[model samples]
Structures are given as structure tokens and as C-alpha cells.
Target: MAAPSAGDRGPRVTGAARGGTGRPALARCVAVDPTTFAAAYWGRAPLLSRAAQLGAPDGFTDLFSPADADELLSRRGLRTPFLRVAKEGRVLPETRYAGGGGAGAEITDQVLDERVLGLYADGATLVLQGLHRVWPALIDFARALGATLGQPLQVNAYLTPAGNQGFATHYDTHDVFVLQVDGGKHWRIHEPVLPDPLERQGWGGRAEEVSAVAQGPPALDVLLAPGDALYLPRGWLHSAQAQSESSLHLTVGIRALTRYALVEALLELAADDRRLRATLPFGLDVADADRIGPELTDTVAALRAWLAAATPAAVAARLRERAWAASRPAPIRPLAQAALIAALDRDTRLVVRAGLPWQLVPDGERVALRVFDRTVTFPGACAPALRALLTGAVSRVGDLPGLEDDRDRIVLARRLLREAVAVPADDLSGS
Candidate 1:
């Protein structure tokens, strides 16, 4: 790839990206109306939103720089799958480019920069996977977009050397939004050989079909420049080549929940049925299609009956669990939070973690504060103060409502600080 240019990049997305009135993360990616996108393009067709049409002058350089990629490759200790190298559609093995960690570190398979440089010089595409977990700017951007789209999102970056095509024409299992950060890339997109493919269905199974389709004229042929964004649904056949220079782009993959997943949840619920749990006919011919026909018919009838009786309310809880598991909360520094909790007082300032989702549910005599997978219950008397904290902004312990005394407010604040649900405000003005 190319070197990081020396100059001011642009305004980058930060923690503040979560609650903005302007175009949201999704709006920034797609230059079209949100309603139009939902009705016409989402999961249905390919849409290219040129950077010029995106309204904001800022490009994605602020999100990641070539310097950042070099730092990850040369400084951070990255392993095999996290940092993969590809040349002419084939992934180079770790043995060819990775080495063992030295001295104090006991692990092997750390990427060697010298090895990577040699591979890149010979025309290899560098794939930086799961960057949202490591890169700060991307972490915030993914969270903001995921919250808006009601689906989990992961980010990866592709940095290809000049004039090289990373992979041959193929499709992804999940939908993607390709945000071009630096330089240029020529993209050729074709209709899907298989539509709306699930995670288990990969393009490798249909290699011949993909190659034949790639030989045909493209449905859309365009050059993605810096600040350009392209949205491609799952199973859309596509390929890209770096232009005259290297191209650095971020691929935001959407992990959308599907009807099949809901059906899985329903089947899990059906396990509770005593009828479904009953054993099959004693000593039955398990492989005889003729003998199994009646049983299959009966099973389908029973399933339909159970499904008719099921309600959305029953399945929603499981869906929430799955969604929360897919999404990530901001990392909290344990020692710092511990210190803050110990020193906390009624005069201390607090800020709610951005994008933290929580709710108060009645739990008998207590109220349950449910955030992510955990539940923190407090006495019903603490309701008003808890309600005050959900404003998603800075607050002072002394200003919290319902707690009659400063000591009680301090106690509640201390618990929350320990929970990391609330953090100490860095600035008094909440700026």
C-alpha cells in the first residue's frame, strides 16, 4: 500500500458520533434519502453514493490513515486471521509471511513487517480484519451505524498495492458498505448467482458460476475515489482492482438477523412441548421414506399448530439476547473505574456511556436496570434517581432526584460507577 500522507486529514467520528442531529452514520454512507434507501435499495440492489453527493466535505481519511495501517502491521502484535495477505485471489499462508514473537512473548504467528513489505511490493492485497475491535474511530462509527440499522456491524480494511486485484469476482455472505478512504479503486459488480445467501452459504461452492458471470458485462462499472461509498447486498458478485496507486478502503459488514433465525428460536421454544419431546414409534424403520411419510406429515401439522399458538412477545426476549451478544459495549478501564468508585461523593460528576442501552423493569419489590446482558436491581425507592441517570448526558450526584440525603445519593452513584454503567465526567461543562 501507499504511505500515510503528511497533513491534516479531516474531522473524524468520535464518541460524539452517537447522538447527532445531522446526517447519521448511515446517512453519511448513502447519499440518498433514508426512506428511499429503506424502500428501494436496502437488501435489494446495489447503490453507489459518490463522495461529492454525500454533502459532508470530510472524507474517510479521518477514520483511518496509512500511518495507522503501518502502525498495526509494524508495532501491534497481530496474528494470522487478523492480518491476512492475498495475491491473485489466493491467501498467502502464515508460514510465508509471519514469525514467532520474540523473548518475553511466547506466541508464534505474529506478522513480520519485512515479510509483508516484500509481499506488498510483489502485488498483494492486505486485509485488516475485525478493525472495529481495535481502531477507536471505527469502533464508534460501527456502533453508531449498527444502532441506526438495528443490526450488528463489523469493519475491515483492504489496502491493495497499485494495479493489483485482490480477489477474483465473488460474493460476500453478509451485506457490505464499502467506504473508500484513500486513492482509487475500479469496481465491477454483477448480479448475484444466489440471492440473500446465509452465513453458511459461501461463494466457494459456486466458483465456476462466479467465473462465468465475471466474464459477462458488469451490471455496474465505476471507479471509487476517496470519500466514495458503495453498498452491496449479500451474494452480489463483485471484484475490485487498485487504480494507478494503492487504495485503502473500509468494508462495513452488516450481520442482519433473518427469518431463518426466528424459525430457529421458535423450534427452541417448541422443545418445551411434551408432545414434540415424545419418542418416535418403537423400532421404526428410520431410513424408509414410505414408512416416514406419515410421521413427517404429523410433525408438520404439530409444528404449524404450535407456531399458531406462539406470540411475538415470547420470541422477543431471545432476539434481544442474540442482538446484545452481537453488539459490543465500549471498553471500560477497570482500575480507573475502581478508583473513581472509591473516591466518589455527592459532588462528583458523571457521564452516561454513549450508546449504552438500558431500561428499568419492575422486579417485584425492586426495580431492575437492564443493560446488555446484566441486570442490576435496586430498591423501588431509588426509581426517581435511576430515571434521572438515563438522560445519556452529564449529571452530578447531588443533582440526582428522589434520594432524600446526599449520603444515599453518593451510595447509589458509587454502585453505578463500579458497574461502569456511568463514568466520571472529564469536563465540568459536559463539552
Candidate 2:
């Protein structure tokens, strides 16, 4: 696929020469030329591109309409350091940040609450859950980026107005790709004095923030117009502010797995055993330390050997599986009682969750359903009956699978549907 030019128009996907499948077409639109991006920002400074984000759905504002923004604000899901205030910083109440460590105070839950503010950074917040639903095009973009980077990708949406400070001048652990969706913003990037810094996840770390020197007079003082993007490597200290009436952007964080995380996960797995779960010999007498030395060394050596033998494919597979398992689908309220029943009774389509694998097989008279590692078969005569339940046909639990018979099937279907593993579709007619 050819690189998108500045004057390119239409859906970002349209710019790419047509390919055989939608996947390939989407791939061309989203694939970041890593070699080009890496040369520009990897371990050096920030790189900005005007219209880099033109392909991004409607440049932020167009992507999230007023109503859509309202819905996101009302969602009480995962919270993070999502909001910014002009001078006050985060708008969430002080109580929300009182618990946990000092880090908890850094994020404001008000962003997740959808409370609107003027002058203050007020806009819809889109985390993984929100993105999973209303943003298929973005998801496709993310998937393509992941494929190009050979790593997992996470895209976060931030909307703010002029003078809003999304974050302080600090470094993140993962590399970031910031795409301006609407309006404009001023960005300042500085060189990192401390190279490849790591965060302390446990207690007992110096509370002082590491200071860094300015690289080259804010390096690039550029205004991000709609459809523009910037790439910054991890450990690159930077800050941003809306330069226009309002600014919206999607920051895609590229995750890099470290040996430390791998070891930590393996240790947690090993802790399930009583022997490994025992307290460490720290603070113990010198005599006890000597006795534990051999065991500790042996364990460490074994872990090292195991990790050394691990293949990149296996690690990627495990990461993908974990990501899919953790993903939560958007909540869809059931239709009204009468409408649901009628719709289900009629032939309808049913679909499995996105990014999940499933298989269907012909059963004696019905069909066998398998999803999210679970499987079940319905009798051929009950195909229509099963369809009703699968398609959200019934209003309440007693609708199709009636409270009396087929209780097991009803329970199983309910569980799958609730988890978003199964969805109803229109019959023959793709909806």
C-alpha cells in the first residue's frame, strides 16, 4: 500500500489501493510505517504530521457526537487519569483520590461520570470498553497498528478545551501515538535525562519525581489540526494544551512487554503452591539466609531457563488470549417485551463477540453453539426455539426457555449473552 499523502481525501481506508478483502483494505489505512516513525522519534524526539489523522474518524469531534459524548460521560466503568482542568487540574472531587497511594490521586473519576465543564477540560472519555463498542473503524485501525508494531495497542480518547492540561510534563512507560481528532493543541517535548525509567509497583520508593533537562527549547512547538498525529517514545517528557476552542484526540499507547513483567506473572503462578507462597527470607537472621540461598538460586535459575525456552509466538498468543478474555462489550438494554418476542420468533441472525473465535456445527435437527471456550448443542426441532432466546427475543427469564423446562440451556445462554459472547442477528438478512 502507498503512504497516504497530505491531500488524500475520503475514508482513510479509501486512500489505500483496493485489496482483496476488507481486512487488507483496512490494514493499508492503519499500517504505520514503523521504519519511518522509528527514525523520527525512537529514542530521539517527537515527530508531528499535519493531516496525519485526517483518516481518523471525522477528526475527533465528528466521531463523538453530543449525544454519544453524553452516553460516555454517564458510564460508570473503568476509571483512569482521564480529565483535565485549566488551572484546577482534575475536576473530580478530592475524596475520589484520597485512597490507595499517591498515584490514585493523579486520575479524576469525574471524566468517567460525564459531567460537563466549560473552560475546564470537559468532554466525553473513551477507554477500552467505550472503544470496543462504538468505534469499529478505530478498532480496525488499532488492530492494523498492532500487527505492524508486533505488539498490543491501546487507544484512549481525550477531549478538552483551550488551557486544559491533560497531564503534567512526565514520561510514560509505553510509547504513545497522539492523533488530533478536532480543533488544535500545542505540544512541548523534552529529552529524557533518565533513560528507560521504570515505575515502582510496590512500596518503599523515593517519592521524589525524577527531573529531566530540556532537549532543544521545547523541540517542536506545533499546533495539531484535525487529522494530525504525533509519535513519542517512552521516557520522552512532554505536555500538551488545547490551542483552539476545544480539542479532541486519540492517544494510542503501544505496549512493550518487559522481562520483569514476565517474571512477575510466573511468580504469581508459582505462588499458588504452598511451598512457593511462603514468606521470603528477608529480615531473617544470617543463619536462615544461608539455608535459603540454594533454594532461591535454583528457583531463579529454573525461571530463567523456562523463559529462555519460551517462543515469541507463544507469548503473543497468551497476551492476545488474555486481552480478549478481559475485554468487556458495551451494554445493550433489552428491547420491550412484545417487540423482543416477535423479533425472536421470526428468523433472526446471531453473532459471536468480536475478536473472539467460535464455530457452529449442524446438530441432529438444530445447531451446536460454541463460544468463549464453551459449547452446547440444541435439537434440530428446537433451532427456532433456541434462536428466540439467543436473539434477546424474550423480555424476562420466563419468556422462551420458560422457567420450568430447559432451565440448564436457559442458564447457559443467559451467561453467554450477558458476557457478550453471543448476540442475535436478523435471519438471512444481514443487519
Candidate 3:
């Protein structure tokens, strides 16, 4: 790809790109009506939203920068798989680009900047995988989106050198939103050969077929410039190549849960049932096959009935719990937080920890505040105040809506602070 000109670069937007109070920032990143997106093109078609000409003016620069790649490559000591090199649709082994750790022939998978730069100059696309684990900005973005979508999220970055393509036409197992950060890239998207393919179904098994179909007409073809965003459903065949200069883009992957997954989870839960736990009859020939078939049919019918009686809301709640538990909170300093809590008072300005989801459930005379895998209960009278803390802006213990007595509000605030559910408003902004 060719270098972007001065005109292509614009003023930078700081802070997180967000839509509305309840809306996910991702909704604004794609420039689409969230309701329309969910109802129409969510898992159906490809949609391109040209939100900006360059350097998206919607505070997206806070999520990533070109310098991030340089830091990871030249200083972070990234390992295999985390940093991969691909050229002309083929992946080069780490041994070809990575070197050993300092002072030893240990063959650590650390990236040697000179070697990686050399490979990049030679047209190898630099692939940085699982960036959400290492990049703080991405972790915040992914967690926020995951809470909005009620599923977990992952992020990866692709840095392709000018005029080079990383891989052949293929489909992703998970849905992807491509955020073009720098330079430009031409993309061609084709209809899915296998609609809604499972994670186990990869393009490697049918490369020739994919190449053949990709050679035909494309469903959508366009050049994505900086700040442009493209959403593609899982199983949509696509390929991209840098225009004439290096291209840097981030891919946020959404691994949506399917009804099949719910059924699998239910089956695991059903293992405790005596009927499901029973072993099959002793081995025999065709003589016993007919009897076994009838029993198996009966079991299937019972399982279907059980599944029918299972509530959809309950299943969804279970999945949400799992996703939240799997997500890691942004790093926190225990000692600093402890000190802040010790000094906390009614005047302390606080906010719900960013990226942490809190749900209030009423249980008889008590209200349970569920977050991560833990639930803390307080008197039902405190619901109003807890709700305010969960949903409102930076607030002080004195500002809790339902609590009339300052001492009561302060006690509640101290508990929350000590539990790390709420942090100082100024500290929350750092993440």
C-alpha cells in the first residue's frame, strides 16, 4: 500500500467512542442504527459504514495507534502465534522470523524487530493475534461490547504491508467487525458457501472451492479507508489486500452463542438425572437392536420435553454469567485501592468500575447485586440507592437516591469500595 498523504491524515479524536448512555460504543463505530443492525444485517449480510474519511473523528484513536504495532514488535517480545508472518496466502513459521531470548540459545518465541521488519519489507503481512489480552484499550472496548451483546468478545489486529494480501479467500468462524485505523485496503466479500458454519468447519478443507467461488462475482467489493468499518457475519467468504502502502486494522470478533450450544449445556446439566446416567445394555447382535432402539427413542422424547420446559431467559442468564466470569477486569493495584477505600467517605466521588456488569435482583426482603461470579445482598430498602450507583454518573455517598441518612449511605459506599465494585471517578477514566 502507498503511504497516506497529509490530506489523508486529520485531527485526532481522544477518549472512547460511544453512542448514547445505554448504547454500546461499537454501535457508533459502525455508524448504524443498533436496532436495524440487530434485526436485519447482524448475521445475514455484509454492511460497510464509511463513518469518516481518515482518523475517525469519533474518539476511536483511543482504541489503537500505529505506534502500538511498533511497540509490540520492537519492545514487547511477542511470541509465536501472537505474532505471525504471512506472504502470498502462506503463513511463515515463527522459526523463520523470531529469535531466542537474550544471552542464550533458548529459542524463545520472541520477535526480533530487525527480522520482522525485513519480512515486512519483503511483503509479509504481520498478524498480531489476541490483542485484547495485551492491549488495555482493546480490553475495555471488548468488555463493553460483550456486555451490550450479552456475549464474550475478542480482538485481533492485522498489519499488512503495501500491496500484499495475508491469506486466500476464506471465512471466519466468528462474526467480525473490521476497523480500519490507518492506510487503505481493498476487500472483496462473497456469499458463504456453508452458511453459519461452526467453529470446527474451516476453509482449509475446501481451499480450492473457495478460490473458485471467490473468482466469480463478489457480493460486495470496496476499498476501506481509515475510519471505515465493515461488519461481516461468520461464514462469509472474504479477502483483503493493502492498496499501495502498509495497512493497520483491528478485527473485533463476536463468538455468539447458538441454540445448539444451549442444548449442549443443558445436556451437561442433565447428566445428574438417573435416566441419563444409566448405562447402555450389554452388547448383543441384531436380536437386541430393536429393543434398544425403542428405549433410545423414548429417551430422546423425554430429553426434548425437558428442553421444552427449560426457560429461555434462564439459559441466557446462565450464558451471561459464564461470559462475565471469563472476562478479566482491567488491572488494579490492591494496595492503592485499599488505601482509597480506607479514606473513603460520604463525599467520595465514585462510579461503577468500567467494563464490569452489575445486575440487581430482588430476593424477598433483600436485594442481590450480582457481578462477576459473586452476589452481595443488602436490605430491600437499599435497592433504589444501589440502582443509582449501578447506573448513574460520578456520584458521592451523599448522593445515593434512597438513603436519607448520611451514615447509612456511607456504610454502603464503604462496602462497595472495599469490594472493588466501585472506584474513584478519576481512577475509572484511566482505563
lDDT of 1: 0.82
Tens digits of lDDT, candidate 2, 248-301:
777777666566656555554444345544566576564676787887886677
In model 3, the runs with Cα more than 4 Å from the true position are 1-24, 51-62, 77-81, 99-107, 284-292, 326-335, 360-368, 373-388, 391-394, 398-415, 429-431
Per residue, candidate 1 scores C-alpha lDDT tens digits across 318-407 of 666777778776666678788888888878888765556666666778877777768799998887787777663228899988878999
Cα RMSD of all models vs. native, in order, equals 8.1, 11.4, 9.3
Model 2: weakest 10-residue lDDT segment is: 1-10
Q: Give the winner by TM-score.
A: 1
* Candidate 3 collision pairs: 1-162, 1-163, 1-244, 1-245, 2-244, 2-245
Please give the range of 10 consecutive residues that has the lowest summed lDDT in model 1: 1-10
TM-score of 3: 0.80
Return the TM-score for each candidate structure. Answer: 0.90, 0.56, 0.80
Each model's lDDT: 0.82, 0.49, 0.76
Query: Measured by C-alpha RMSD in angstroms, how accurate is candidate 2?
Result: 11.4
lDDT for 247 (candidate 3): 94
Tell me the number of clashing residue pairs for each predicted model.
0, 13, 6
lDDT of 3 by residue, 1-431 (tens): 11111111111222233323333566645676667778888888888988552234653456777898898888877887788888988999888888787876476778889999889998899889888888877766776676566566788889998889998899998899998888899999999988888777888887888889999999999998887899999999999999878899989888877776776667765664567676666763436767778777868987777666666555656665666676755555578778887787778888777666567777778887777769788898888888777776337788887776988888888888777777777784323
Model 1, TM vs. native: 0.90
Of 1 and 3, the candidate ahead on lDDT is 1
